[model samples]
Target: MNGDVHVDLKTDSRYAGRLQYSCSNKICTLRITDLRESDSAEYKFRFITNQPGGRFTGSPGVTLSVRGLQVQVRRSSVSYWATLMCYSSCHLPDHSSYVWYKNGQKIQRETFSSYSGNFYYPDSYSCAVKGLEGFPSPSVCGHGHSCNRVTYTDRSICAVKGSSVNISCIYNSYDTDIRSKFWFSPERSLQWQNPSQPEDLSEDSQYAGRVQVLETERGRSTLRITDLRESDSAEYHFKFTAGSFEWRSSLPGTTLTVTDPDLQVQVIRSTDYTYNQAELLCHSSCRLPDHSSYIWFKNGQKIQTETSSSYSDYFDSADSYSCALKGLEGFPSPSVCVYGQTCNRVTYTDRSICAFKGSSVDISCTYNSYYTDIRSKFWFSPERSLQWQNPSQPEDLSEDSQYAGRVQVLETERGRSTLRITDLRESDSAEYHFKFTAGSFEWRSSLPGTTLTVTDPDLQVQVIRSTVYKNYTEAELLCHSSCRLPDRPSYVWFKNGQKMESVETSSYKDQFYPRDIISCALKGHEDFPSPSVCEFNRLFQRRYNTN
Candidate 1:
């Protein structure tokens, strides 16, 4: 060995990762590993020749400095909507990509080059919690541009991998400056998803790539997944960034269920019919109502084109099962048996609640047995007062203006049926009854109707300015209550022997100061037309207007 040579490592394993080296020594080769700075010095070379004084020499050699990349948040002090820039002080070359981790979560990455300057190339980005726009102070964003930013994005829920869902987006910023918005799969894999804007879009695999954001507003996005698989159940997150701002977002996903139409036949929506011309109705309700199909079959024969809204929408009509609804999938099964209240084997479910014009409530029903083979189910409210379903006393599903389409059946089948009602007014309050039929047996229960007592919230009423007109201009009567019940209570104002219609709503907040519950006010009640003193009550309790 006569020459002295030097090998300078651009980076050691630590500054980067790990290092490996091998040397061929004479009759055999030598291998060494796990090398670190501790072994940063001398090496000797030897040659095994037949000569005893064979060649042997020592050389003072190269220094290998491992420059590994370590990232850190500049400042620990942080607030909502703040931006924290990342500072990387490393003299490294354009090798592999750089990955950024936030709160231990790996964000997008960045690509560095020999010619790229740290100042021109941003490794620091801004972050806002959720979708709120505003700078969160003292924040840290990893720099390594693996993916671009997502801006002005919206999210919605739907069956997984079913169909790509459209999420609306908006961007008032520059278009060319922003490159793209990246879609992360349930597994957090980065993939360019379909941008569903300015046209029709489809769901993708894992989202089927069916998701798309507007090209102009790439940050605004919509997700579409097709052939929804159960494994597709998970949360999907998206991160969008443009020249100056970056947005990080995520959505909690939902599950997918491919359901079959629970078909069957029966008539029981209206009044008690021992045997009369009562209307027979059928009903079908499911989470994804569109997936369920309806067919009218009699004695193993499918009936086509003869079902009415009444015949197929209800189960126990005191009437005839003469009509059927066809091509209507997602609806409960069809019914052929004429409805009646015959055998005392009576069975049913009833639940109810009360609320003011601005509150919410839920109702439910159930049968005696909770079987599985039983396919179809139905629900009806006596308030519906269906006419044809029950001639003598029909609880019409179509005739009741108050009930409308507000009722839905919660399918916990083989057992109870539930319904959710929202934004209830006083008029929405009532003793809602349930009539469900599974298998060949029909059940009706109404003894203890589900009672919902939605007491009115305090009402607030007052003319914008004043109610003192020159000759008493029709004073506006405002009726307001924070009552949790939807059924609104009718108000009767009496001044003398005269009657006045007390109209208007919402008076005041429920809890005021310390103990003041609420207040309601109504106008137009005069002492002459009927009675100036108006009586407002729910469940028969007069609520004196105090606002």
Candidate 2:
């Protein structure tokens, strides 16, 4: 039973279909399927015989916990090597050995919680418990990359027409002497004389005055487009030449989709009819900037108090509603009749997501059909190449060999579906679209979908001089990551491969000798420690000598 509610294993909607109970002469067992985090709880078993006062209850009960595995990357900024630790949400047996995989191929000899090695870009990595190899952590990309590599900040972006958008990327080259670097688009060059040549946006007459490529940092560049138009939508790539080689322009870059400047009011009715209220949203095809403000109108009259994108109140069938940008009030959206319009669309919870490699992610969408019974639904990725299948058919993600044993589509409630992907890999980066079929109707596949970008997590050890002394130096060490850890995990420090006791914080301060080496890791993942760094480096020694 869950908190005073008798868990009806046979008839209740929540448990009846998924829970199975079996009994032997002296032993009984309960089985549950399609488990969720919410199912983590205490359970008690009770049995009653025909005789009076013969009922028996198992005291204390049994606690069940469910958890997922995650891969944590640890590295120092100065080193090329990274340490990968397979961690679980809940603690496992201390003796548990881990299995490691690189680019889906298992590493033969790795059997520890952590593995340290030189990780490079393009290749993905993951880990699992030795006995549970089927349930590995999501695949992650390496923090380091080969010299000639370019990484885009975003894989795809959707922008409203007439608005500005910036597509950025960072490039690296081994050659210190650079030749030239510029942004180009293959789509624009298709119509040019040399169809095979890359066309720089700066030289294109279409974007002459509106495009600017700004080098914000040494290796980072931003292509800012002002007063965007539908014609400006294309795949933008960055190319650079150094020494004898040029970065390939054929590699996939950022995809930009420019949409029309139109809006619609999405009506979400309240489940309870007695309330007679509905939630209204000023919906746009493409996601707007976070700082954008909206204006709401009811029956052609501006609602002064409703400036946000969403509004909720009791609705009247006679009323009509519309919305517009705060500054562009003249171009308001077409009015939508309340309770009279047919609704058929899919709204994603997030337009885009940047997730850590070797992690699980859920892409969810709420779908509505006008007036027919929904029949079938599935999720597919348009980014997947159709070289091996029918070109006209969109293959489901579940049927794709690349995502076998890693993808699941869940429909826990009506009108909502969630796509859960485990052991995420950099190759899994794509646009995922959901399709549903109703009586005589099917959701359009041309509609925009959610974009997923999988990136590798990085950890580094930062050293700061706290105090100076004649013979030695006192310094503070910090364990840093590219992103915040989920639970503010406790840290473990190591000095020359030996674990330091009683130190659990990310920061550690102490006096050190010239021969000392330092490294760190998350607590309970001691096997995968950060690359060790000499506590006393040449720079520190020089400073001491000068003093």
Candidate 3:
């Protein structure tokens, strides 16, 4: 029927609300909705006219077939359990009977929006709607660890102001129906006689659009807060309810500490060492934990634990010296140089770095000590929460499961140390501090070590076209990545498998073609280019074919 006189099914009760018809500029349209399993049939149109023998039936009819339900797995974090939701991609009648399976065998039949279970790593599971049990969803494996009770991945987190952090926990429940899950910061635990009755943080305007709960799966949840502020600092806890049984984590919940930037002194020392003279240096860790003044001390006495972080004076082999924050004198950093032992002030080259994922990065720092015979030097992560505060590193990071064989303690000599990590993963991102010890002095640089960020470059391409002109086939291609690098690298553009000439910027303008493809990547990372996207000059097709 050449875009005219489309059949109208509004008057038929069987097709009411399921059919929609309209005619715009002689282009007739018919739409269907709320399809059911029994709606399969051959559809045709018939046209009628006022003159004799003017009625005609459509020559060919279209048959409609519907697909079954699909399943989606949701989890709070990658390291938790999952909840499977069986749903149809399109509108369909609801059904209560749903079957779940683990590795091809049926496990449960229920009438709930979500099916819950413990996530066993490497074990595959799936679900299907009752009538279509034979066509179950593709099997998926559970990621991360399995927990028998509610547990947090980390008990405390320190974030930089304006950065984001995720507070994640795993929970288990015996109740069949989970009513709610949320995160909140309560000043006192005594107030929570009924933990489930507390208000959700998302409802509070202070965190209106800035906070979100990631309930990706049953028994797992994560509270993500973005654009952090000092006001957002609090002890956060997670709560959940399944039917009548409600539970809140009693363990020390996740504590968030946000710090702003401040000015701190940098320790600079001379490499020259003499038998009769010893030098000691002290400086700010990164720029600001922002200690206003630094006090230097010698062997537990306040005599000359002076105001400056750096102090250089003649040394007797038996004399020892340490430093402390000016006002807070109780806990002084471990003494640096003592009794001709390794005593040095350590400093990092760069406090923070955002590196590409799957790439290698070097976290470098320099140190100055009185003892030329350095006893030990290594790197550690303060956020890792392990008891590594010792004269020697607690364990070789190269042997740690996360960094196994991927981490290298670079050679340290003449006041320098480095940690080189390869095959960078998102999990590798952290603030790595350096530590060293000689004879009687042990030092851990907690201030401004290297903060490494591993990011996967996700390129997003935006296609723009002229709105007013027809057959004017100029398309604007704009490329962007998920992260903003410190130095903001230039973009690399590719067209039809070849580098584009003079298209080094993120935005490029080009004339449209039927099969012309364009893609982009980071200037130095062109090997992994983004998926090529083709631009179609729809203006040309409309002007030539629609007439």
Q: By TM-score, who's the top model here?
A: 2
lDDT agreement of model 3 with the native: 0.62
* Root mean square deviation (Cα) for candidate 2: 25.9
Q: Which regions of candidate 2 fall more than 4 Å away from where they truly are?
A: 1-146, 190-194, 268-278, 301-306, 327-334, 337-547
Ranking by lDDT: 2, 3, 1
Tens digit of per-residue lDDT, candidate 3, span 1-547: 2267343344333453355667789566667764545567677766544444566676687777765565576876645657877776656556557776553346755556577766665344556666754345544555433312355665456664665778898766455566887888875321233323566888777887899888788667999988887778888877767666555533356777765422222222223334444345543222223334667655434654367655666666544466656654533555545334544566577767887887788888877655555687677786565745553454456557788878887665656777899988998888887776677776654344577888867787667433313545566878876554436478888877788878788888877665667789988787767788764443444434432
- Model 1 lDDT, full chain set: 0.36
- Give residue 28's error in model 3 in angstroms: 84
lDDT of 2 by residue, 193-214 (tens): 3434576788889897999999
Clashes of 1: 142
Model 2 weakest lDDT span, ten residues long: 8-17
Query: Whole-model Cα lDDT per candidate?
Result: 0.36, 0.72, 0.62
RMSD of 1: 28.9
Question: How high is each candidate's TM-score?
Answer: 0.27, 0.37, 0.33
lDDT of candidate 2 at residue 320, scale 0 to 100:
62
